[model samples]
Target: MGDNNLLSIPPTFLDEVPGLADALADEPLNRVAASFPAASLPWALLAQQARTHGNYVNAYAYARTGYHRGLDALRRHGWKGQGPIPWSHEPNRGFLLSLFELGKAAELIGEADEVDRVHTFLTDSDPSVIDAILADEAAHAPGTETIVIRGIN
Candidate 1:
């Protein structure tokens, strides 16, 4: 498994969702599904996990949640989306990473509108954002492993 951990997610949020514990105890796919109910780091993790397991439906759900939450986080930080996300915002990394995930998820789920929206945002934002997220993923893992965000429309 990849070691791309996100920032700490609030325990309260996870606790509020029913069946979280049960889902965690179930098979891997269930755990990923459990993550879909939360609008936080878990969504991003779930998106990646589901995609890895070839569960495109769940991946799309989780990725969309992650993308929306990321956008909300940016909005909270006063991001107008006119340029690259500001470096000072706490969720900058998460938001940028979510865009990559969302783009791929949209493509997998055949959501052309979402793909176009994400692509427009990426085109407007700094190209280096994706590289930074990938670098962080590599840094957290052993050896030269990389996380590839492919076919971002």
Candidate 2:
């Protein structure tokens, strides 16, 4: 008889979405989302955009869609519900980004339980991802001016 080990789940690496990069580079985020509804990256970007515009409800909706789509992709790629979704993988960033956006939107919308759940999920997947995502976002922020302080003359 074979032993069933529930503690040894393998890591999941999702396949690349066809033309996703091209569409993201060339099209508006809305159009990109419409073109690639199955891919999590566009939806994640949409959620981030909505959040930036203070549309918390829209952000939540988009992030939710991305989260579910990511879950589907994870299942399709042999993820048995629990594994390290590493942040170092480029293709995995969409799902991780979606989770981050979901948690942020959930917090803004007062979905405290959802926020907590997402936090737990992200940490469980890979504790380093949250900081990685935040750092990436900070690096890409628009009009990010540097401030220098000196003693008053």
Per-residue lDDT of candidate 1, residues 21-115 (tens digit):
45556657445445544334567667777877889888887777777876665565555545455323433544555677788788988989888
Global lDDT scores for all candidate models: 0.59, 0.87
Please list all clashing residue pairs in model 1, or write none if there are none. none
Give the backbone clash total of model 2. 0
TM-score: model 2 vs. ground truth: 0.88
Cα misplacement distance, residue 18 of candidate 2 (Å): 1.8
List, residue by residue over 1-153, the lDDT tens digit for candidate 2.
022232376677888888999999999999998888889989899999999999999999999999999999999998877778888888888898999999999999999998888888888787799999989988888653565557989
